[model samples]
Target chain A: MDFEDFYATSKDACLRAVMATVGSRQLAEETVAEAFARAWASWPKLSAHPAPRAWIVRTALNVHVSWWRRWRREVPAVEWTDPIQPPPDDDLPDPRLMAALRTLPPRQRQVIALRIFLDLDTETTARTLGIAPGTVTAHLARATAALRACLAPTTGQE
Target chain B: MTQDLHALVREEFQRVRLTDTLDDVTARGLRVRRRRRSGSVLSAVFALALASGVALSLPPGRAEPDSVRLAAWSVRTEPDGTLQIVIRDLADPDGLTAELKRAGVPALIEFKEVEAVTEPGRLAPHCADDGEVRSPLLLSVMVRPTGTDKRAWAIRPDAMPPGTSMHFVIFSVRDAAGKSYESVHMSLVDGDPVPCRSVS
Candidate 1:
């Protein structure tokens, strides 16, 4: 696909997953924005991959962990300074669910992001994470339980 | 439910900012635009070349040239048993030789520009006398010089008996600008040079 088509289809969807994993909108936007720059520079290679969305998400996730970005390389990116607040709307997710998700470890958050937001199955999630299937299931189970409990107590209030 | 989690995540993500994503995509799309343009141009050029090559290799107008060549070879045996070959316009002497050879007549052919007729009373041998000029196929003949190329030539068949061959053709072209009237004369008697004779 051309760059426009790929970006239009993938940008919002990937942004959501990255946002869920990083637990901060600013960082997620910055990470995905930079990841997309890198993807465009080498789109011919990335577009051929079986899961380009997974690849972009993984690259964004890796930047969050890669010491090189923190210490060495100034990877191509723009500083994201857009307003982060969502307008008040009933369609917004229950605050309790978002709060419950924030409490989980980063690995479990990644599993939820890939599995729930991105809709990858177990094997693809594991591959995206560079982890085994059992580990993905374990993290997914724990994160689900935590969210269930957090939602169970809340009755239409954050 | 799995659907619930998906819905919740998608909904919350609606909050994040997205300002210059379109500009970024536009920049990326520009990078590949050259590749597409160049590929189309190359295909167009290749198609043009292929079409021109096919058009160039086909034959030119055949009927006109063939008819003119046939008229150049119009001939009849004189009452004295000599052959009278009328060459009116420009004709390939080599082609005329082929026609004569096919008619069981062994002969030699030669072509010389009019400038070659310098010796007094010995001009380049062509049909100038009225009796020898039955069909003036051309009104004028002009042989223009391109470089230092020679205009005089001679063709003597190896098989013709130089002394006994009674039938031979000495067709000569003139030195005028347009519509050249050339002639070919053949003798019935043994002679080294077939003298240009009266056609009547």
Candidate 2:
């Protein structure tokens, strides 16, 4: 598809995937803008990539990992006390799951976000995050275990 | 337990609400391209202005050396569109925001020192004559506003020969939209009244 169409259709989806990875709306917004601007600058090169979505997602991820952004708040996990009124898109993860996801290491959080939120397979997730496929598996495994434990009801009811 | 975990994790994304914006991104993408063109044109103008400024200092008979000196903080626009503003003291410069307003830019510009650094050698000669600042004064030049939605760029105090502190002016832009964005444009100067050079 053309750049405008690609942007209209994929921008929000791409951002949500990144939001799940970065966990901060403002930072996510900035990252998305930077990536899209770069994409526009070199659309010819990027449009030809084998997996354009993967490239866009990877570009957003690269912005998150930038050294300057390293100075951003180091929250272990985000805490959401109230459920946001459902947006037009009814599909939102439970806050408990979001909190649990945030507690994971940033790398692990990114891996799980790509795998679960974007449904990227192992190789694609690995490519987007610039990690080895084996590393993706390890992170996924650990992240899955962590989420399971963290979200498990303490009373053993859930 | 593993099966249950997978189910719960997968469910989390099912109702995921996204917060990305397309309109703003689309607008910004276009602006980014235009800025590159403006930057190049401005560079050429700056070169021409610099060359002619030294050679054609004053017009023939009516020219006076007295006309050359200007107060620090006088706003001037380079051939390329960067606005050069001077910071003489701390608080808001009395007429700066107003002057900038007249330039078609809606801005509330002020100076807050993260750390104090003083350099007086660069002041405009006019300040010395008026005893406004003597011996050492900052440079001042004429600056004009070029457009709306212009990003506020800063000139950091340039490296001094000796005994001067080094600090950079940081211009953080908070547009009407209430979203703060930093332009790639930045300036580094040796002292006050230095050109707010465009580094982009």
Candidate 3:
């Protein structure tokens, strides 16, 4: 697909996927927008990829990581315990789930993002994250178990 | 239960939408492309200058007319022997250091990729803060911003104490809007000082 068509179709999904991972709608918007801009800059090569959406998500996450590293170095004393900001819209994901997701190690949150939001297979998630397939399974299992425990009372699941 | 969890995630995220338009993305993409192009061109120019050996043969005591101005940085020597250094970009720290040394100032220039720190502690990676080395005379060699994007330092070699050398650690950070800013920490080191470990 052309750049415009691809952006039109995938922008919302990409934004939601990034928001789920970052736990902040504003940061997710900026990160995903920047990633899409990068995708546009290299559309010729990126359009031919097997999973351009995955590439966008991965790029967004990488951008966030870079920014976070810089921020951490600049402000070493401040703790980044709270990443989840209140969503502007009430229809957004449950705050408890987001808090739980934010508490997971970055790798686990990334695995959940790829598997649940992007719906990528184990091998694809592994490739996107640069981790082993077995490691991907392990992270997804741990993340899911943690989220289930957090949501058990509301979901009525043991 | 797994399927249910996945469905819940998908359902909730479906409500989130991106408010930015395609035109916005395209505009930002053009900016990114332009920055990349300019960076590559600067690298090529630096490489050519280094390959020509012009950067090494800069004469002592006075800055050459051509060597006085560069796209990334400039170094000039005043009649009284004070060296003026204006940095526009942090691309070639080695060349800058060489130029400073040629101008008769014992100098170590390091362009490090570090963000500005609000808290007071270590300034750069692998470089320790030595409170003993700081002196009132070193204040004369500090770099200050002359413009919005340019920072200039004036160094009086005569005022520098014996057995002392100037060390400049430049830190660069890009804001969320993609504009780059630089901060410099100047110190007077005694004898030979160890190089700051590179973190870029």
State the C-alpha lDDT per candidate.
0.55, 0.51, 0.72
Query: How do the predictions measure up, each by TM-score?
Result: 0.44, 0.50, 0.61
lDDT of prediction 1: 0.55
- Report the C-alpha lDDT of model 3 over A1-158, residue by residue, as the tens digit: 99999999889888888887888887788789889999999999999998898999999888887766544443111122433445576757777778878888988988888888777899999999999999999999898889888888978843
What is candidate 1's lDDT per residue for A1-158, written digit by digit as tens? 88778888788778778877776665666668767866776788888988888998998888656522322211101121223455454534456666777899989999988887778999998987889999999998898878777776563364
| Residue lDDT tens for model 3, B19-71 | 88989999889867875786686688778898987673222322455233344
Show pairs that collide, candidate 3: none
Top model number, TM-score: 3
lDDT of 1 by residue, B83-170 (tens): 3354433346556555555544454444433323334555334433432222121111111111111121122233234343333344
lDDT of 2 by residue, A45-81 (tens): 8888766666777787786676243223111111212
Q: Measured by C-alpha RMSD in angstroms, how accurate is candidate 2? A: 14.6
Q: Each candidate's interface RMSD, rounded to one decimal? A: 32.8, 13.2, 8.4
Sorted into a CAPRI-style docking class, model 2 comes out as: acceptable
In model 3, the Cα lDDT at residue B101 comes to: 79
Better model by DockQ: candidate 1 vs candidate 2: 2
